[model samples]
Target: MDTTRSARIILVPGFWLGAWAWDEVAAILREQGRDVTALTLPGLEPEHPARGEVSLEDHVGAIEAAIGAGEGPVLLVAHSGAAIPATVALDRNIDRIPRTVWVDTAPVVDGSAMDASFEGDEMPLDALWEEELGQGSMRDLTDEQLAQFRRRAVPEPAGAVRDRPSLTDDRRLDVPATIVCTAYSADDYRSYAEQGASFLAGVLEHRALTMIDLPTGHWPMWSKPAELAAIIADEADAAAR
Candidate 1:
């Protein structure tokens, strides 16, 4: 835990988004003199022919490759659905990462497919996501920002979303995890974990599970990049200790 050691920060964006979604946050973190790389999951490009071919395993491999690129353990920052592959990478090799910061999402348990019942190779931006992420996070954005976001937003591949993640190692639970609560409060998330919500059961019970309160909608990176970057930097420093 050398505080002065240069550490790599891998930024993972959720569905319907590419590396561009993390532009603002990555820029702020870079200004802090930390190494940062935002990943674009395979098959997420606009009009990708392999959209239906991309599976959970493929996403896991992409994240794994990124983690392997660094010389030492990197701090992973996962937003929304990207948590799926990040968890897979951690579960497969926790030593590759010092810790993970989950943004507005909980770890997806093994053998569970996120939005499993969903069909189609690509799903359009619907009302629920519109309310939770798109429009709901507009309080801090200008008309131009919202318009650009909508224009750049792409359809998420169903294969990756519907495919189930596999975790063979329990050591992933030993890896440090911190949840940045935005769409909900720390108290609300605690209650859910206390009630043994399936997705959070293993993660919430981790010895290093930390919940940081950041009141806002699901897409805090878009609405509160400065605040989000500050929180993530603080968490990374703490993890290095």
Candidate 2:
């Protein structure tokens, strides 16, 4: 155990998921000799009493607390919907985070809400929610995977997803940031690649941001844990260099 080589990597799962979602990835990272912490946001666990009322601020606070608990700078990995909270947290506590990795995630630009990111014709959140409810427990995952996921999946806090993110113009941080987009289907891959390119174009224009593409689905940590862990470790190493 080389303590000096240990890097604190905090995993922030997407909506309707918990720390359990990152079990495999965390295990792999640990095996590779990196320190990893998988976070379960306030409303993510079935046992959490505030499951319905947990706000974006609450989730951000949780991430901040986790980062503060660590001894040094952390590499915050935000997946899907968690990207907003993670970005806001880094903005709020820029001193604590060393880097950020957005995994098949969404980034909310200035003055944009989650709702605003979607085009006028698509209803992603609503449609996805309805489909998930109809399918019961897991929508896209296989039976075995869904069983594993359901053991941890709880209803996400309504406010956490609804609230808008607030970021300051003090744009760049001391650490580097990377966005890894994973798309299973060709259409999804193309869509996210375009989104990632557009985002990297905007406010991120002047910042030192890295972007990578993976040939996996949105939940790569579950479907491709080894690959995901390797990519994350590579990013962490790059930041160190």
Candidate 3:
């Protein structure tokens, strides 16, 4: 396999996160002589003024633009809530993205959001979101991490989380994909199964879906960046073959 030609990988962060989340992971990949770019979705950073009105379309547009300017094929590495927008962007620009890697994230089928699967149930996401916002940086993290998280973590746009994506009828993508699972507890794995089984089942058809259990919380890129980057780089090299 020609590893040189497979260096392009784009990292997409989840809701309330910016590209800064991938700083350590990007550094690791770069140390290995790989090309990586971490993107900040609109409304997630202080520079983006449309935090209140940004929609799912805007999120996808930001990723699409990044892929458009890149050279050759890209392996999109999406984390947490980014899986939906990342996949939607690939579906829209199928020619640019050659592979997708979902990490500790919720997978969406067709154009559904992560919340769609819990339509009839009482999910804890709403409460978690409210609590996290109300408590601010005190919600989750040590004192050191809180200061940093506060600088980058911003309020998610209402429409982006609520709106359903527009998907193409084509079920198959031009490139293969893989799912890397990172959960802190057994309950987290069960949650992924319950909310994202439908989407995961579909991904199994056109690609080789692999799951790696990271004992860290949802953000392995921050907790174990070197390991995460190695897994991603290895999978990307294999996918190119």
The whole-model lDDT of each prediction reads 0.79, 0.69, 0.68
- Put down candidate 2 lDDT per residue, 59-110, tens digits, no spaces: 8899998988868667889987787788788887776666778887644454
Query: Is 1 or 2 the stronger prediction by TM-score?
Result: 1
What is the lDDT, from 0 to 100, of the residue 143 in candidate 1?
Answer: 72
What TM-score, over all chains together, does every model reach? 0.90, 0.79, 0.79
Show the colliding residue pairs in model 1. none
Task: Please give, for residues 2-113, the per-residue lDDT of candidate 1 as tens digits.
Answer: 4457457888898888999999999988888877889888887786786777787888888888888877668888998888888888888777787889998877678767
Show the lowest summed lDDT stretch of 10 residues, model 2: 116-125
Best by TM-score: 1
Error of 1 at 162 (Å): 1.0
- TM-score of decoy 3: 0.79
Q: What C-alpha lDDT does candidate 3 achieve relative to the native structure?
A: 0.68
Give a tens-digit lDDT track for model 3, residues 17-64. 888889989888887778788998877766666555677788889999
